[model samples]
Target: MRILIVTNYYEPEEGAAAVIITRLARYLARQGHQVTVLTSAPNYPHGRIHDRYRGRFSLSETRNGVRIISTWLWATPSPRISRKFLSQITFMLTAALRGLTLPRPDVMLVEAAPIFTNLAGVFLSFVKRVPYVLDVHDLWPDHMLTVGAMTERHPAYRAARWLVDHTYRRAAQIIALTPYLEQVIRGYIPGMDKVRTVYSGVDLERFRPGLDDAAFRAKHALGNARIVAYIGTLGTAYDCLTMLETAFHLRDRRDILFVIMGTGTQQQVVRDRLAQGDLPNVRWIEWVKYTEIPQAWAATSIAFWALFNHPLHRGAVGTKMYEALASGVPIAVALEGVVADILRESGAGVSVPFGSVDALSAAIRRLLDDPAYYARCSQNARAYAEQHFDAEKAAQTYEAALLKAA
Candidate 1:
């Protein structure tokens, strides 16, 4: 099968979509499918074009086996309402125009975040006459509004709705990471027979306790304390400040440390919070290579999957959750939603209801102080990672989605 994946986030860029697409493309390519990724020069959460691809219109390259076509898109220094919408528009146009000339794809897998990517899917469904699938990463305007990135009744919302509705109406099939997003789509678009849910998969084999390296930890000085980490985007949707508050609340436990790793739009604000007080227990790690994640694991005692409590978060799944489990470290997730349900079902971690500083602190303390419960959580974490979150499962689910769409 020849597949074309259009998304704003991809390799050299970092985010949930980037990781998801990269893994899927590689996995599919290995299975003898031809994959073409139509994306922009790597500029993401930081809002700056990569130093290497700067000032270029588009560049085509191959990573692993997938053909990557990088194109022009809006680059912003910060996440402003006007700039984000423009960026999505830029991506949709350039990617669509580029994919038009390429060989006819058997399936068009368009990621809906930029919302413009769906424009390409909208065209491919009607123009190229390919069976396009819109992977609903978020509910678009609704999510943007939730994050305060945009207004609910704004013109852009209506425009995005129109484009998405067109694709939803036209596409052969639909995939959503969470049920919450699926319901959101059905509410607006009506017909829902084509939609399906496939939670994101983690490479449990790569993300496990055995990978921990002492040399890497010593280099980063990770040897000094018990680390509780929040890894992934610092975007508005992630309530990492709450993790900081948890750290501050336990300041008396000097042995406990909070390590924040990853990049995003809210980085400056995070820095401000770090500088405002004297919490030496906190360490802000910029971006770390995925290959070096074992270092992160070696250094941390607990992993915090902190997300902003929102309706969208209920069905959302990110790799960080499984990664924490794979590392044999207990998870402390404070953002209430579907995640809590999964955690409770698996007994993999403790859940602190969202926005409750006291609950978050108590959960952290419970994991830290109780040996048997903490060990059970840790063991359950690893067991869950192996049983449910491996990349093999992810690849299989992705393959099934395409085959089913066909």
Candidate 2:
């Protein structure tokens, strides 16, 4: 089988979609399928193309038997609506043009976010007469509204909805990252028997228990303090301000240390708060290599996942939570819906109401102060990861779905 994956981001870029798509492409190639990825030059989170990929219209590379073709797109650091829309539109046009030159595949699997990328896949599928699968990572228009980027009555929102509905109806299959998202898709295109919920799993080999905790702690000079970590993009969707408030609430506790390890548009806001000299117990580290994530997990006692309360977020299931489980660390999440339900079902962590700094601080304290409960949660975390979130198993499921769509 020949599989063509269309996405906005790919390897050397650090994000959940990049990791998932790379893993899937590699796994499918390992299974004797010809896999190729069509993506934009690596410029995400920071919004500037990497030095190596700059000034190039298109470039191609291969990694582990998978072909990667990167096309050009506008780069801007501003999170303004116009800049973001321009970036998406440029990628959509370039990717569609590039797709026309490629060999027609048995199936086309596309990462649908920013929504506009789906246009490339739809156009290619129509021209080539190949079945296309819409792999939805996030629901747009709704997400834009949640972040105050647009309103329901806005012309842009209405146009996005029309485009999304058209794509959903035309897709041969829809791959949703969470059950809630699957439900939402089904609601949009009712009686579509093709939607499936496929959770993004973690790499068990790379992110299991028993890392060099001592070395990590020593390197960071975290002397005998309990570490609670929030390790991912610090973007608008996340309530990072609440995390800062939680840090302030626990600032007097010398034994508790808060570590935030990522960068995004909201970085300056957090930096300003830290500069106020009120969060001495808090520490911020810029993004690290993906390989070094295990070390970060090793130094953590509790993993924190925070998101702003929004209806759009109800369907979100962050990759960080699965990574934390794979690392045998308990979770402390401040969000509702799928993630909270997972904690409740697996007994692997505790959850609190979103935006409640007091509750967030209290949850961290409970995990730190209660050894017996902590041990149980830690054990459950690893067990859950092994049973439910293995990458190879997810790849197999995806392979079957793609084959069926083809």
TM values, all candidates: 0.94, 0.97
Candidate with best TM-score: 2
> Which residue pairs come into collision in candidate 2?
none
Backbone clashes in model 1, listed as residue pairs: none
Error of 1 at 11 (Å): 1.6
Candidate 2 residue lDDT tens string, 246-325: 88888888888999989887898888888899788998887767777888898889998678888778678888899999
Model 1 lDDT tens row, 137-241: 777667776777567678877887776687787767788777777787888877578887777767766677766567766766767688888877776777767
Tell me how far the alpha carbon of residue 215 in candidate 1 is from the true structure, in angstroms, after superposition. Answer: 2.8
- Give the winner by lDDT: 2
lDDT of every predicted structure (CA atoms): 0.78, 0.87
Candidate 2: list runs displaced more than 4 Å: none
What does candidate 1 score on TM?
0.94
Q: Which stretches of candidate 1 lie over 4 Å from their true place?
A: 149-151
- Could you tell me how far off, in angstroms, the CA of residue 372 lies in candidate 1 after the best superposition? 0.8
